[model samples]
Target chain A: MQSNQELEGFRVELRDWLEANCPAEMRGGEASESSICWGGKNFEFASDAQRDWMERAASKGYTVPTWPVEYGGAGLNRAQEKIFKEEMDRIGARSPLDSFGIWMLGPALLHFGSHEQKLHYLPPIARGEIRWCQGYSEPGAGSDLASVQTKGEDKGDHWLVNGQKIWTSYADKADWIFALIRTDREAPKHKGISFLLINMEDAGVETRPIKLISGASVFCETFFTDVKVPKHQIVGTENRGWDVAKYLLTHEREMISGGGQGLSGGRALGAVLNESLGEGQEMETTLRADAMRCEVDALATGLTLERYKDQAEAGTGAGDASAMLKYMGTELNKQRHELLMAAGGSDALEWDGPLGNRPADWLRTKANSIEGGTSEVMLSIVSRRVLGLGA
Target chain B: MANLVMTEDETMLADAARGFLDKSAPVKAFRDLRDAGKTHDAKMWKEMADMGWAGVLVPESAGGSDMGHAAAGVLAHEMGKTLVVSPFLSTAVIAATALRNVSDARAEKALAAIATGDVTYALAVDETSKFNPEATSMVATREGNGFRLSGKKTFVVDGALADRLLVLAKTDDGLTLFDIPADRAGITRNAQNMIDARDSARIDFDNVEATGEDVLGQVDSAMSVLKPAIEAGQAALAAEMAGLSAGAFGMTVAYLKERKQFGTVIGNFQALQHRAAHLWCEIEVTASAIVNAGRLLDEDPDNAIMAVSLAKARATSTAQLAVQEGVQMHGGIGMTDAYDIGFYMKRARVGAEWLGDYGYHANQVAKHRGF
Candidate 1:
């Protein structure tokens, strides 16, 4: 860990830089899902400020702060990056850009990608030129992800992809996808897999949006029929995609475990509850108690997350314990929403009122446990990996 | 305010404590103590004192190490792994905290005595309500400059063996704390055998005399002393509970691997594995909670009470579930006294209910949060 004096000095420099560069519109206190910028081909900026924010932050390599500078990152150490985030949060600055490319693909490429692959793929991702969506789960492979049936025939120079992926968040809008494709059909379920990156604009590729209960079309079912992917697009070894998939899943779980941090965009949860419940009115004791416990647990989880981050910075990634964080983090998020719903009462059900947004946000948390990996699967991993239980 | 990682000395202390307990007094030691109708091993208590645990919280000026609450918690956690029945919780933790926080010279003398393993103390705070310290209504009437305590204190842990009793009492001004010899006149102790095979007592304090110098802290401001003492006790208890649950969880996992059923070891079953995994996750969270409490107690004592409650609450419930699953997963043999799993279940129940149960601590957490 850096000395407090060094961190404080860095904070001053970072604060000055952000103040001079961050656009006024981009400093909006909280970001709605629709307001988030996901850059790609045909991507709408929403506002010039949005575009400028992404450009400036990316130019400074703030998009992926902790990654090496060679890969279009600020090359900040964990402590420095944390301090930078704290400064950003202090100003309630909205995230300059949000993309699966940054959260999922960038990490996988850095760890498992070839030097050439990192140079080719990571810079564009850091610059937000391409948006990415995951294709790990097919209709038949929700929880059992390695049992993917998406076959990628081994062509001499390229792979022929033929498969369908379900619950691909933002796949309809994404520029490309990193998918788990079976390269060797005769091998075991896990061994024959390959992680292939394919563009969404390829011929025979199509995506149909899946409407959620919240009436959002954020998710899509994607189909790839003989969409040719270059052999160079493969992430690790030809048939060792499971390893890459697993590694990416760790990052994905870490991202989801961070759901609590993003949900309100740095707004105080109590402020939201107060808006619905009416300030100064006494909340039911039981509900208040439940909220208190949830908040404390959230604080504890936040500390746990920091510990894991520090552990990762120390060169030992959280590994399977990420499952524990994912499990607890999602549950904490659901509980936060549950309390919000309870606080809103009948007003929370209003379709277009101030409290109306609580319902949809609460519903979105339902996927926190199910997506990435189900809570049950997470527990199974915790038991098997962390506890060394079972055969 | 939470220190996630332990200090190097703290980690060394924990390692040494665990290593010593593993060799000197494992679960088999607990078995022998129970079978022999003894709540604690005198030889092991002396060893712990020699290892400087008894005076862990006391200041170095008073012939003690003053390692702070977090280090003491490390040893407490280790002791918890073996279910080592000792006066560490009542005497070293609770009584020593009270002695360390006061200005009285007699308190320093008691601290030196505790350091030398010549004296042990049990805190008498609970009445009929079981674990609530604020429920104390025992009277201590003033006589000249001193006071005379008269009341009944039930559930005084290790009270039967304590050389002195640190009593929480009501005064004309407010609540106060006093430390008096267990052999003092008009103090009658009825020893009770607890379910966990620990020694507890119901004491009737009939006009027990106390000097002005015997007061643990300023009169009517005993909450200051009592609160930290209990917080220290709860932090240690939480760590112990974490240790107990971790131990039980480990034992159950081992049993699942060795105990065969139908055609294969039961551990091969996904159903059992998932349940065990859930328990393991619960234990991890509980362990973190305990660490947070210990760290907060040392780093930020002003707001440490809430973290203490959080730790005790989570550890209480987690240990309960761990012991329950330990027994259920072990089948019929777990129910028998011949197997060690049953002992853990019994010990967990006692530890969970002690100091404060889950509901009590959760309620405190809510109160502290202004809910």
Candidate 2:
């Protein structure tokens, strides 16, 4: 563990910086996907306060605090990055920016992209100047993602890109798409793919929204019809995009797994129960027990996540142990939302219910087990890879 | 303050304990003792005390190492891994916690003797079945300057074998805890053959006389001392159960790798593999809860109720999963009496019911969570 004595001075400075710079409107901000600041050409902030907060955070390199200072970051270590987040959370200040560029593409670029590519791509992501979307999942390749049919023929100068990508989150608002293209059709499914960075402004690119059961259009069906992409824009070695994709998938999985970092903000199950059931009113014993069980399991999951991080900090990486975190964390998240709806009762069914986003949030959690990597796939990975139970 | 991951010192201590337990006492040793109709071995107890295990929570002034609760938890966790049946929890953890709270000369003497491997203590708390110390009806009526104790304490683990007993009794003021000899007049210990093959008994205290020196802390303040004692025992018990889960999981995984059916290992089958993986995740998560509980107990004892309850409840459920899956995955061999896995199943059952069952701790969690 990092010594507190070393972090004491850093923490005080961070706390003061957050308190002074973060606007009152941004503190305890709206916890909704619609209010998120996903910076793009057409991106408009929900309020002036939101815009100012993002600019201030970007200037201080708090958006991607661990990135190198040359790439618009604070150059903080993992320990300092943790302190930065904690100080921000202490003031109830919401994250200044959220996008696929900062989370998924930036890590892939940092690892697999060339030094020039990192210089060109990473700064914009860290500054939230451009929003990005992942173009990996297809109707044909959900769990078997390696069998991607998006062909990218070897056109000497600039390759031709064509195919469809499903579940491209915020595709309409995104300025670019990080996609996988088939460069060698004759090669094996996993061997032929190549990671491509394509601008959404390219003529053939189109995005159509797909409404979810929660009555939200957070995802889109993105089509790449003979779109032109410079050969130099490819990440990593060509026809080896599977390596980059897998590396990026781990980040995507951890982020969505919600191990102590779920989208559910603030209020706990018991507090929700008391709010709806009334403070003095006696609740159903079984429901109450269910709420308590959820709380206990959530506590266990959070500690497990922290332990793994500590293990990583101690130079013993989480390794195969991380495979199971996605399974446990996502399952627990789904369980929490299911109990949340149960606590909300008949009132939860109302469109504009007193339980703000409780109904929509409940439906959204259903996707948690399906998106990123399904819970079943995570279990299989744990069993076959970690446990060595494969035939 | 809550460091779920062990420090360098704690890791070394665990490594040492693992080496000692594997050599001196393993699963085979527990099986042998069960076959011999014995709950514990006195020579083994002496060796443990000689190694300063009995003094893990005891003070240096009383000739103990006084390694604190985290070190004691480390020892208990290693003991549980090998199914080492002893009075480590009852004597070193529970009784020592109660005795150390009182500054009397006799209490100090008892602790010093405990450090020397000359004394073992058991807690007598339960009345009928459930662990509700607040409802303890064991009367401690004033008789002149002394008190007459009359009550029956059931599920008294190590009661029949311990050198002394810590009894929770109701007094005119409210509830009082007494530290007295088990062989005292009017105290009868009827040994009950438990499923775990451990030394548990129903002790009857019929007008047992006790002086002022026998009382721990003061009259009507049993909760003051007993609360911390029980919480300590509960956290240590949680660690033991977590260790037990890992032990059972290790055995099951080994069996999975070796046992074959249909021209391949059964572990290769997706059905069993997923179940094993799920169990592993449960064990890992529950281990964090156990570690956090010990941390909170050592660093922040006053507000450790929620953490302790969460740890106990999570450990109890996780142990159930581990043993149940351990047997199911082991198939027919797991059910046979000749196998060691059955012993783990029985021991897990005992741990579940010892301090508090799933429902009991769940309620505690709900209460603190304000539901």
Candidate 3:
């Protein structure tokens, strides 16, 4: 545990270090899909400078700063890690890698994986040597996630997986998937599930990219036909996969909620609103009020997040309150993008090249309310669990 | 950006006020206050004064804690929860604000008295059912040693009980605020029973005399002080409305869980659950808006007008929806006097219309936009 003074000092040091090391070219402006470095089996870079930048950050473990040193991480404590994030933000440093391996799978593996699992999976995840995508949602089991029909039958020495996963983000580019499969069809929907880590190159595994309104193949329909997942890859208890699924869902919600700050590149929401809507137009009143309302809600949600982060740093988890935050934050995020589209008006309709994706990006935000747990589900959880409204 | 969120100290103050209100001024206290036709409770006022709530916003140099408007908003919020019948808002916030903004020696001294709970004052600003303080029709004419004020002020909060009335009057220079003693000759206070049962008054200032030294601000510069003071008042009212909405929403939720319909808790139904969730979100957003307005009021008075107006509009709509939906969700018991929801709904209506209605504030915001 570090004092506020110590944290401030660490922040200043990290600030200085980032200022000297980070290249001016790899800074603040938005990175296209081509510019983004996803270091997996298929990783490539257009320029030697970009490749060198990725290698430098990866070698120093700055790519995953807070992960354990043994797995190519700086191993900084929570406070120091926060300071590192703030410093990186201050210097406008671009992340060396952006993938499910870094954001979703890494944390889940750290928490639930065996020692062998951690050693094999984490180093690659930290080194940006693997790209992962989620395999959770199905056409029939969107919000009612417990009703997943994906099955994993145990063979003599391996597990045979057979089912379809829809809305699997980045499945087309992913090298691995952490999925949920029913190991016992006779058991209850929740009890029959099991967590399995699967290789994307396994025989009979297929991925078809879904063309989203955002003009990008960010999600895909993944089908597993007799795909063999090594028995050793089963995480936690085979029959008790629901617990692992619940844990992952919490992290997923947090990740989606955290996505709020990442969408708008370093610009204050107020500034964006002002630019989109000309100053003091009569027609802009409703839009201005809505934008202001969203801004205030964002601030409130952000402050609530900071409070939770503080508590987490102090080793006191907010538990169900995190659900409250996730619910509010995702709604606020959707509202923000809606306001942006409203502000952009006709200009928002124009989609070509990169700008073509703006409309899709806006449409993708609509999924936020539906995914992770529909807004309705979150509210029900809050009412029953947090508010104690139902016994 | 002095953390718009509540600090530990602010939370402690809020919790203490909440605890006191729960124990002392329950729904019964509100009933008693309303039934007795009393504008405020002296015992509760003394308890609050003892707790230093009255001095929460007043400068310490003027016998106050000088904590600022954020703390005052918190106190008002707790007051709303208990439906505490008091002139805390009218005297401590509105009048004290006018005095503080005026920044005169006499006004400062008056504020000191207010901070100490030794005196109470009401601002007589509203006339002709408008939110504009500059539209005041009360006249202040030059007289021998001082001035004579003549005209009427409607819906003066706590007018019958206030020791001093900070009357907004039109002088030859322009609109001015005059602190006329309620007991002064030619002053008549007729107590009016509002729909919410809160005590207000129609005050007639028939050539009431007051010295130029009693003027609140530079003779004609009352608009500067009045506008911001009105904004602050609206913000405080919005805070109270937020608290009231929270209370009503909480009560409705509790009743819904306990009162079964169709052999299951009403709360178990998806329709009721979604409705309650939406109301909760609305209240949460309203709370943020009001708190933001309070912060703006303290830091940037120039933007306070817009912030407060926006907050008032949001809160008025939020409170109205929460109360109406709360009652509907609670079933038939909600409309009965025995249930607490009706009282909250009435109080919310009063708050919504107090400084300005939602439409009025929205129009004001548009006008401020130069539309």
Candidate 4:
């Protein structure tokens, strides 16, 4: 571990730099989809301040601070990255960019992609020049992700793809997609799958937004009809994409759990409820008690996450333990929003106005348990893998 | 306030405690002691004191290892897993904490005696069913150079066997704490037959006399010493409950793997597996809260209210879940006296109401969180 003095010095320097570079407009704002910069080739910035903030942060590789400099990152260690995040949070600095490429695909590529492939893709992701969407869940496969039937037939120089992928979050807006394709039909289900990168702009590709209970089209049903993909675009072994896909799923689970923290941001639910009630007003005891329990559980979840990080630093990785985090965090997040809705009361029933996207947010949290992996499947995985329970 | 993970020395101490407890005082020992109708075993407590656990919070000058609260929690947690019947929490944690706050010669001697296992103490509070020490109705009227204590303290844990007692009594100023012998004149000790089969008493202090030397800290500010002691005990009890949960959950999981239903192992059923997994997740989260509580009490005891209450609340709820699931999954065997799962259920029930129940702790946390 580095000395506290050294970390303190670095934090001071980082704080000064953030103060000088971060736009005032970029700080102290709720992280909503409209204000976020996805930064694809066709993405228009919400404002000049948003564009400037992302470019300045990306130039320093703060978007993916822990990745190596050669891979378009600041080359920070874990402690430094934590310090960077803490400093960013102190000033209420909004994340310059949000995309699947940075969270999910970048980690998978860093571990399994070829050097040439990393150089070609990682820089664009770090700089937010490209947006990526995951295509692991097909129309036929959700929990049984390895059983995806998206066909990728080899044709000497290229591969022909034909299948449909559902729940491709932000797929209509993504520039590229990382998909699991079935290349070997006669082999075992898991053995036949391959992870391939596809350009969304390519011919015979289509995307249609799926309306959700949240009244927003955050996900799309992406279709690949006779699409051609270069043979070299495959990640890891051709028929062993399941390994890379599984590894990526771990990152996705961590990210989903982290999404709870993003929303929580250490804001007290009691205070939120008090504000909703418009001052000098007392929240009902039952609702207040429920909110406190949720807050306490959220705090516990946060501590659990920190403990796991410390354990991983001590050379004991939380392998299957991440499942517990996802299940609890998502559940707690939903509970928090549910309390928020109840706190809002009749005013909460309104679609818009003073309540501010909370009704939509509460409904959106429903997807947290269903997406990535359902809570039921997560429990099954924990039982089988972590506990080693046998038939 | 402190590191979420234990230090190297703390982890080593925990390993040693686990090894010794598993070997010497496994669940069988608890069962045997119960069969003999003994709520506590002085011989086993002497062995623990010989191993330096009785002085975990005491200073080296007072014949202790001074291993801190986290280390004490580690030992207590291990004892909890085996349902070790002892006075470590009441004597080592609470009594030591109370003694450490005041540096009087008697308190110092008491601390040294506690470290040596020559004496044990229990706090005499809770006049009613609940544990609101501030609501103490026990009055001590000034009589010459001493005071006469008159009150009944119900649910005085470890009071049955403790050599000394820390009694809370209302004085003209406010609430005052008196440290005196349990065998003092006019003090009647009638031990209760708790469902958990633990050493608890409902004592009637009929004008029990206490001198100025017996007063710990200032007269009216007894909370200065008593509050920390109680909080220390609460955190350790929380740690114990966390371990008890893990122990019960472990037994349940093992049973699930072995028990067969409909020609298949019961563990293979999704119904049972999900419940087991959900319980495991609850235990894991509660473990972190317990760890944080220990850390906070060690580093920032003044500001540890939120963390300590959360730990106790989470541990109480999770332990309840573990024992309930344990019994439900174990079928008829769980209900039989021959099985050890019932012991955990009883202990968890006792722990939930010990320092403070779930609602009490949650109220504390809610206040800290500005609810």
Find the candidate with the highest lDDT and give its number. Answer: 4
Q: Per-residue lDDT of A1-391 in model 2, one digit per residue for the tens?
A: 4588888888998888888999998876325555568887779888998989999999998888888888878888767866776677667687888788887898788888888999999888878888899999998999888988988877788989888999988898889999989999999999999999999999899999999999988889999888989999999999999999988888777666653233222335586567777557767878888887887787778778777777776788676666677788888878877776787788789766787777887787788777777888888988888778876
| iRMS of each prediction | 2.8, 1.6, 5.2, 1.5
Cα miss at B190, model 1 (Å)?
Answer: 2.3
lDDT of 1: 0.84
Clashes of each: 0, 0, 3, 0
Q: Which clashing pairs does model 4 show? A: none
Worst ten in a row by lDDT for model 2 chain B: B1-10
DockQ of 1: 0.38
From the highest lDDT down, the ranking of the candidates is 4, 2, 1, 3
Candidate order by DockQ, highest to lowest?
Answer: 2, 4, 1, 3
Writing each residue's lDDT as its tens digit, candidate 2 over B1-371 gives 35467898889999998999999899889889988999879999889899899888889999998988888888888888889988899999998888888888888988898887889999999998888888888899998888999979999999989989999998888999998989999999999899999999999988899997788998889988899999999999998998899899999999999999999988888888889999988988988888888888888888988788888999999998899999988999999999888888999999999988988898887677566
For model 1, the superposed segments whose C-alpha errors exceed 4 Å read A11-61, A81-96, A154-157, A261-275, A278-281, B1-3, B6-12, B103-105, B367-370
Q: How accurate is candidate 2 locally (lDDT)?
A: 0.85
lDDT of each: 0.84, 0.85, 0.77, 0.88
Which has the higher DockQ value, candidate number 1 or candidate number 2?
A: 2
- Tens-digit lDDT string for candidate 4 (B205-245): 88888999889989888899999999999999999999899
lDDT of 1 at A353: 69
Please state how well chain A of candidate 3 matches the true chain A, as a TM-score: 0.89
Per-residue lDDT tens digits for candidate 4, residues A196-272, read 99999999999999998888998999999999999999999999999998888877887787675332345566766
Q: DockQ, in order, for the candidates?
A: 0.38, 0.67, 0.19, 0.64
- Who wins the DockQ comparison? 2
TM-scores of the models, in the order given: 0.91, 0.93, 0.80, 0.95
